[model samples]
Target: MGFKSKRKIKTNFVSAANKKLRLAWDRKHRQLTVSDWRKWVFSGKTRVNMGGSDSESFYWSDVPGTNRPHQVRPQVQGISDGVMVWGCISGDRPGYSTAIIDGAIDSNKYVEILKTSLMQTLE
Candidate 1:
């Protein structure tokens, strides 16, 4: 409800198949918690607090300087060609490093990374 973001795009949740999947996941989570699938021996709610984070980096190549005249040619800098790297961290565990294809990432590509690298870190 109130968790909706200001920049959110409106969509029909009831008509979305993904909504059913999310609901199923929530149901499983609730079931496991109820059945004590993971026993809480610690006094606090969180014993070893589990967290995950990921980041992306770009590496740019340096361009060589030219001896052309200053007034005749505009100032030129390095080319925009770069490689992107994605990595994640979870407590002491680290996920595998991934290279984004051509500085572009879509839903399918992101899911593949999650399934491989991110999943390993989580496990």
Candidate 2:
């Protein structure tokens, strides 16, 4: 057998309603021209993991031996340490981003980010 160990790919579960909404959104925007798209700024937020990920690892070896330092992953003490960041970009240029200094972003924080980063990007 020519099988090798591999890590499982993680994926998010999309609900049927979410799928329908995405399809509808695509249909609505499918007719938009390049200039129309250029006028749009796509924005999103993600967590930048400061610590190592909590995922399984695999290695190949002909004989069983002690695990090397590189083979072992560090275990974080608490919740995965990471900082949340928000950014936006247009068709022509990248935009500014800000780290969530205090906590998770709320509606107010989102508006503030839009007022600062998004406004600067548009200008």
Candidate 3:
């Protein structure tokens, strides 16, 4: 047996429709200049696991190949076991972040985060 211990690759399931939409979006913006891209601020939210990720998993593969179905772990987004935070970055510098101590962010909370973190980042 050629089985070897390896860390499973984490991935999210993307619907066919979403995949097509992503391709279309990519095509639409493929010609964007660096300056055009620089004008945009990238922002996102993520969960910072306190101890470690509960989703960490391992797999065995005899065949040494990349992205085999068995080696790919499908991750489903759910309530985080630790803190959630929002942050952003421009072309030049990283932006401020807001840690969610309470829980999930509602619209009001999102607005407040933007008002404070994002606003401060822009300044």
Candidate 4:
């Protein structure tokens, strides 16, 4: 099966496709806005705020004390998936966002996309 055809896509236009997917992820999600897709990226996964101190912002800690920081939190990832509005900006209002977050969170497709995106970006 073709890599892309395996997916059920709508409005099959490259220029608008990415935007559509992003908006889809924004409509249903409550925390991470469509603008925060960067966090779902593998590069961002390791760098996002896990949970350390009670600072206003996300911080990374590698200390050997009682308050050692954790830089990796799957809950954040779950939140990312939950708040994902997969296909937005296609509704009424013409630039409207979607509320669909039906992507396989831990499926091969998820891994493949992230791996592919990471390779292209990091490599």
Candidate 5:
């Protein structure tokens, strides 16, 4: 006779997230109005923020072999480059897509971009 494999029984457990989502659905179901939607659209105060970032590696790595371990030397090829873009939009108004070119986005650089690009976009 063949031995039967022991399998775990599946459980349908409702987590805290499921409870919260169900409550939110129950509260918001057919409760929104046209005026509420219009206000939300015009205010541009949505729950989501739009943002993006791009990066490029300046150094290359040698392919690793599974047979044995090897020590690799690091090389200074060039500067690590990257850029970040972000913006928001309202119903009729368009937003600005600001891009900052830097290796790291610190507070000082962030403020600089806001002062330069963001201010220009606002104007």
Candidate 6:
């Protein structure tokens, strides 16, 4: 036995915590399958008078003009994929970067997490 030092479980715990943080930022992190983003034809009435009316097929970015203050709208012209991730994170640290340490989001890891969470709810 050529063991150098004692195995620290706290160190392992901290490592796991860091991974959970990466997961939070990856909630909207999805790979773009195509080189360019998809764009809608957008050929219709330029201005739509909602007039406080509710519609199922409406988006905030649909408004072409930027008049609202503190309202930085995304150019929906570039339709990007926004996937949902059921992971935890420390906080909104910006940059939205996720680190999948040693292929963390593999099929096995996903299945294991699902099983564990499901088991908890059953109890």
Best by TM-score: 2
Flag clash pairs in model 3. none
Compose the digit string of candidate 3's lDDT tens values, residues 1-123: 999766668798999999999999999999999989887889999888765676755776777867888677655466445888999999878999889978888899999999999999888
Better of 2 and 6 by TM-score: 2
lDDT (tens digit, per residue) of candidate 2 on 9-90: 7898999999999999999999999999999999999877777554556666666677777667776586647888999889
- The lDDT values for all models are 0.51, 0.86, 0.84, 0.41, 0.51, 0.39
Question: What CA root-mean-square deviation does each model show from the true structure?
Answer: 14.5, 3.1, 9.2, 20.1, 11.5, 24.0
Model 4: CA > 4 A from native: 1-63, 68-80, 86-94, 104-123
The digit string of per-residue lDDT tens for model 4 on 1-123 reads 655424343444566788888888778775765657443432211112334322333444556444434444333444443333222122122222223244434466445544554445433
Find the 10 residues in a row with the least total lDDT in model 1.
41-50
Candidate 6 weakest ten by summed lDDT: 39-48
Backbone clash tally (model 1) = 0
Give the CA lDDT, 0 to 100, for residue 21 in model 1: 87
The per-prediction tally of clashing pairs is 0, 0, 0, 16, 0, 0
Provide the lowest-lDDT 10-residue window in model 3. Answer: 72-81
Model 1, residue pairs in steric clash = none
lDDT of 5 by residue, 3-109 (tens): 86554665768999999999998798558766555343211121121222222223334654533223433334464433555454444356555565544567887
TM-score of each: 0.35, 0.74, 0.69, 0.20, 0.32, 0.19
Query: How far does residue 37 in candidate 2 sit from its true spot (Å)?
Result: 0.4
Q: Candidate 6: how large is its RMSD?
A: 24.0
lDDT of 6 by residue, 1-119 (tens): 99765434333345777888888756644553333223211111112222322232323555677766535333344333233233332222211222223322667755665466433
- Cα error, residue 73 of model 3, in Å, equals 22
Candidate order by decreasing TM-score: 2, 3, 1, 5, 4, 6
Candidate 5 off by > 4 Å: 1-76, 79-81
Task: Provide the lDDT at 95 for model 2.
Answer: 92
